[model samples]
Target: MKDSILRLKSRLIRTLKLENLLFKFLPNGIYVFNLHRIGDRHSCQFDRNIFSCGVDQFEQFLLLLKASFDVVDVATLSQILDEQQPINKRLAVITFDDGYKDCIDKAAPLLVKYQLPAAFFITTDFVGSERIPWWDEMAFLLRQSTGRVFKSLSTGQDINLQPNTIEKQIAQVIFTSKRDNNHTLVQILDDMREQFPQARAQLAQQSNSLFMNWQDIHQLKDMGMDIGSHAKTHNILARMSTEQQLHELTLSKQVLEQQLNQPIKYLAYPVGRYHCFDQHTLDNAKVAGYSLAFNNEKGKNRFISERYSINRYCFDEGDLSTLKLNCIVW
Candidate 1:
C-alpha cells in the first residue's frame, strides 16, 4: 500500500509539473524521439502546440540527450533490431516530422554542432507550396474570429470563444473538424474566411515559406540527414480508403526518391496514433516499398515485431527539461 501511494505521488507530481521525475521509470530499448516545430514557442500566431524548443533550449536538450543516451540514426537502429541483439537502455534516435521550416532553419545547425544523425519525414504535397497545414489555419481562424460566439460552418455548431481562451478555442475547432483529408475542410476555412475577412487578408501577408521546399530538402539531405515520407498529404491513414492510403504512401515515397536520388526506406505514419493507421496502412507501407515505419506511441521498441509500428516518445510544448523527460520512453 505504501509502494502504491509512492507511485501515485510520483505520477501526480509529473502530471502537475511540480517535478519532472518521469524519466526515472524508463525501460531498456531504442528511445525514438519526435519533434515537430523547433522555433520559439510563442513566436508564431498559428499552432504554438507544435513548437518543440527554442534554439538555446534545443541545444541544452541535445546536450542532455548526449549525456543520457546512446544516440544513433534510424538505419543503425534498424540494423541493430535485425541482428536480434539485446535491447540497450536509452538507445535513442531523433526525428522531426511535418517538414516545418524550423527543422531546417533552427534544428539542423544545432544538430550539426553536436554531430548527431536524425531522420526528417516530409509531407510531399505541401513542400514548395503556399499551403499552410489544417491545424495552423484552424488556429489562425479561431484566434482571428472577432465574435464571442464562433458559428462553425462546417459542423453547424456554435463554439464559445471565451476571453483569453484562444488555445482552447483552437483545440475545440480542430477536435470537431479534423479528418483524413482537407477536402471538406477547404470549404470550412472559406466559410470562416467569409465570416472573418480581416484575418484572411492578414494571413496572405504571412510567409508561404513555412514548410521546407524541394531545394531546402535537398540542402538538408546535403547535410547528411536521412529523409523519409510523412505522406503525400498529412492525412490520417485509417480515416482514408485503402486506395487513398496506398496513394499517400507510394506517391510520397516515389516523389522523395525522385527528388533526392536515393531509396526512401522509412515512413512515419501521418498523425501516427494507433487509430491513425490500420492493418491496411501497414500492408500498403510494405507495398509502397518502405523497410520500416514509425509511430508516436509511448512504449519501448524491444523486439523485431515493432518494425512497422516503431514507437517514439515526442515533445512539442514544454520547458527544456520537461520536454527532455517527456521524450524519454518506458
Candidate 2:
C-alpha cells in the first residue's frame, strides 16, 4: 500500500516534472549529490551498487542540475559558508566518492564537457595500490562464498548475501558496524580469505585496474577538479579510538597535501552512514586541519548547518524521472 503511493507520487513527479516547481518553493540551501562510479552497473564484478550511472544519464543530470540550481564545487561552498553568505538562489554541489579510475576515465570528461566542477573524495590506500578497499573486499568475498552467507566479524552475526540485491548492502552493515576495531577488521578479512581462498586470489589479480594511480589523480587535478581525503583506509571513524580516528584523518590529509601540493581541507567520511562518525571524529577533523567535512546521508545543507557534518545524497540513477524522484523525496 505504502510503496504504491510512493510509486504514484514518483509517477506524478516524473510526468508533471513537479520537482521544478517544488524547487522554487524550497528554502535556499546546498543540494549536495555524490556519485561513486559512472558506468553501466552490469559490467561491474565486485560491487555493482557503486555504479552510479552511464554516460548519457550523467550528461543529462549535468543539464538538469545546471538549469535548476547554482551548481558549485565544495571549495566554493566552503567559501560561502565561511563568509556566512545568505544564499540568493538554491545551490547544488556535485561530488564523487572513492578513488575509482572511472572518475578520470568517464566522469571527468563529461564534467569538463559541461563546464562544471566536482569534488572527488579519495580513499588514499586504494589510490595507486592493488589492495581492494574494505567494501569491495567484503562484496567480492560474499559473492564468491558458496553458502551465500558469512559470519559478521565484529559480532558473531550471520550476514546473508543475495546477489544483485543485498550483497553490498549487507557488507555495508558489516563493515560499518559500530563495534568495529582494527583487530576485528583484520580478523574478519583473514577469516574471509581463509574461507574463500580462491576469491582472495582472484580479486588480487583484478585489483590492479580498479583504482586511480597517483598520476591519474594528478592529471585529474590538472583538469581543474578538487580532491579531498576519504580517509587512509576508509574505516568508520566512530568505531575507532580517538587516537586511531585522529591518525586516520591526519595521515590521509598529510599524504594528499604532500602529493597534490594543495591543502586538504575537506573530508568525506568513509561508509558515511549516520553511525559511522561521532563527536570525537568531528573534533579530530578540525584538529586535522579540515575546514569542512561531509557524510553520506540524504538531505540538503543550509548555510547555518554544521560545517563538519554536511549532508550529501547518492545520485546514481539511470533515469531522469528516478533521479528527480530521489532528489525530491530525499
Candidate 3:
C-alpha cells in the first residue's frame, strides 16, 4: 500500500510537472546535498541502496541541478553566507561524507567531467586502517551467520535471524544503541563475533580496499577538492565527554592538515544525527579552528543559518522526487 501511494505521487509529480511550478517558489539560498558513495550497487558488500548513487542516476541529478541552479563550492558558499550577500540566483553545493575508495575512483571523475567542485569529509582513523567501519562489520557478521536464533546480549531479546530478518536485526540494534547513549551496539557486535569467530577474518579481508589512503587524499586535494574532517573514530560527539569530543575534532583537523599540507576548515559530525552532536560539540569545533560544521539534518541553509550546525539534504536514487520537493519546501 505504501509503495503504491509513493508510485502514484511520483507519477503525478512527473506528469503534471509540479516541480517546475514549485521551483519558482523556492527561496534563493544554498542547497547543500550530501552524498556517500557512487558505484555499482550489486557489487557492494553491505547496504548499498541506502547510501549509494549509481553513476547514471548521479549524472542525471547533477545535470538537473546544474540546469536549475548555480553549482558552487564550499568556500564560495561560505563566503557568500559570511558576507550576508544577496543571492540573485539559486545555488547548490555538493558534499561527500565518509572517504570511500569509490569517491576517488568513481565520484571524482564525474565531478571533474561536470566541472563541479565538492568537499570530501574524511574520517581520520579509516584512511589508512584498511578496516571496514563498525556498522559495516556488524552487517557483514549478520549476513554471514548461519544461526537462525540468537539471544541479544545487550537487549536481552531473542532475535530470530534468517535471510529475510537479518537487516531488521541490524537496524534495531543500531537504533537502540543510538537512542540509549550506551555502548550496547558494541556489546551486541562482540557477542556476534564470539559466535562466529571466522567472520572477523572474512571481514578484515573484504575491507582491505574499502577506504582511501593518504596518497589518494593528497591527489584529491591537488585536484582542487576540498578536504574536511569527519572526526577521528566517527564517534557520536554528544555521547562522548567534552574532552573526548575535543580530541576527536582537534586531532582530525591537525592530522589532515599535517598530512595534506593544507588548512582543514570544515567538519561534518560523525553520524550527524540530531543526537550525535550537541552545543558542546559545536563549541569544540570552533575551538578546533573549523570555520564551518555540517549536520545531516534535512533543509536548505539560509544566509543567516548557524555556521556550526549547517543543515544538508541527503538523497539516493529513489529520492529524486522527494529531493525536488525538499528543494522547494525547505
Candidate 4:
C-alpha cells in the first residue's frame, strides 16, 4: 500500500515535469518513433504493409510537414549542429526506437516514399535477435502465469490479475520501478517467472523473438538511416551503480561502433526518464567518447551539457497532429 502510493506519486511528478518542460518551448525539429505501430495486436508481421503515411490522417501530416520545412535526416541535423545556425520551420526528424524488424518493413517504405531521412536508435543485444524487450518480458510472464499476479512490497498485498489486465498491471509495476526504493516490481516479475515454468520457457523463447538482425541494421544503413546506441542491456541507468552504468554505456557504444565500422556518437538513454540517469552517467558517456546523447524526455533543445543529454519526444497512437505539435513545441 505504501509503495503503491509512492509509485503513483512519483509517476505524477514525472508526468508533470514532462508536461511542464514540453509546453514551454519551440523545437527545432519534430522527433518521434517507437517499435510496433501496427494495430492488429496479434500478428507480428515482418514485411506486409507500410501504411503509416498512406492513412488519410498520416497523409495529411506528411503534407503539412512537407509544406512547413525541410524534412531532414541525421546528416542534415549534424550539419546544422556543426553550423550552429537554426534551420527553417517544420524541420522534423523521424526515429524508431529498438531495432524492430517492422521499422525496416513498415516504417521504412513510408519514409522512402516520402523521401524523408530518419534515425534508428537500437539496443545492441537485439541488433541481431528477435528478443521481446525486457519490459515485455515482465508483462508476458504476468499474462501467462496462472493465479495471483503482483504483491505490494510494502503492504504484502497479493493482487489477483486477469490475463487481459496483465499489461495495465505491468505498466503499474513499471511505475513502481521508478521509485528508487522499490524492488517490489522486480521481485514480483522474478517470482512470477518461477510461478509458471512452461510459461517462463515460452516467454524466454519469445523474449528472443522480435528484433532486427545485423543484416537488417546494414540494410537500414543502406537506406540512409542514422544508427545510434540504446545501451547494451537497456537497463535503467540510475538503478545501476556507477561502474555498472559505465560498463553498459561504453560496451554498447564499442559494439555498435565496431559493427557499423563508424563512430557511434549518439545515444538514447535506456528507458529514458530524467530520474533514469544522472550526471555520473553523462560523465561516463563523455569518457566513452560520445559527442551527443538523447533522453526520451520530451522537450526543446537548448544549451546543455555537451549535447550528451539531448531531449526527445515520443510519437504514440499514430497521432500525427500531436506528433507535429510536440515536434514544434519540443
Best by TM-score: 3
Task: Put down candidate 4 lDDT per residue, 205-262, tens digits, no spaces.
Answer: 6435567888888888888888888888877888788899889889998999898898
Query: Order of candidates by TM-score, top first?
Result: 3, 1, 2, 4
lDDT of candidates 1 onward, in order: 0.80, 0.80, 0.81, 0.64
Q: Where does candidate 4 stray beyond 4 Å?
A: 1-39, 42-64, 152-156, 178-180, 184-188, 204-208, 302-306, 324-330
Q: Candidate 4, after superposition: displacement of residue 243 in Å?
A: 2.2
Model 3 Cα lDDT, one tens digit per residue, 1-330: 864766676667777879767765677777889988887765666655345578888888788788888998889877987887887778888999889888899888888999989899999999967767767776677667746566666667877778776767766756665665545456667777787678777876663667899999998888898999999988678988999999999999999999988889999998788888999999999999999999997777666458899888887653677788767655
Q: For all candidates, what are the clash counts?
A: 0, 0, 0, 11
Better of 1 and 3 by TM-score: 3
Number of clashing residue pairs, candidate 4: 11
Candidate achieving higher TM-score, 1 or 4: 1
TM-score of every model? 0.87, 0.85, 0.89, 0.77
lDDT of 1 by residue, 1-330 (tens): 864765565566677765445565556668788899887767687877778777877788788778777899988887887787788577888999999888888999999999998999999998988898878887886777746577876567777776477787787777666542443666666777777677888988887668988888998999989999999989778877999999999999999999999999999997788878989999999999998999987655766585789988776664755454444423
Error of 4 at 227 (Å): 0.7
Model 4 TM-score, 2 decimals:
0.77
Task: Write down the worst ten-residue block by lDDT for model 2.
Answer: 174-183
Which of 1 and 2 is the better model by TM-score?
1
Candidate 2 vs. true structure, TM-score? 0.85
**lDDT of candidate 4 vs native?**
0.64
How does residue 305 of candidate 2 score in lDDT?
A: 68
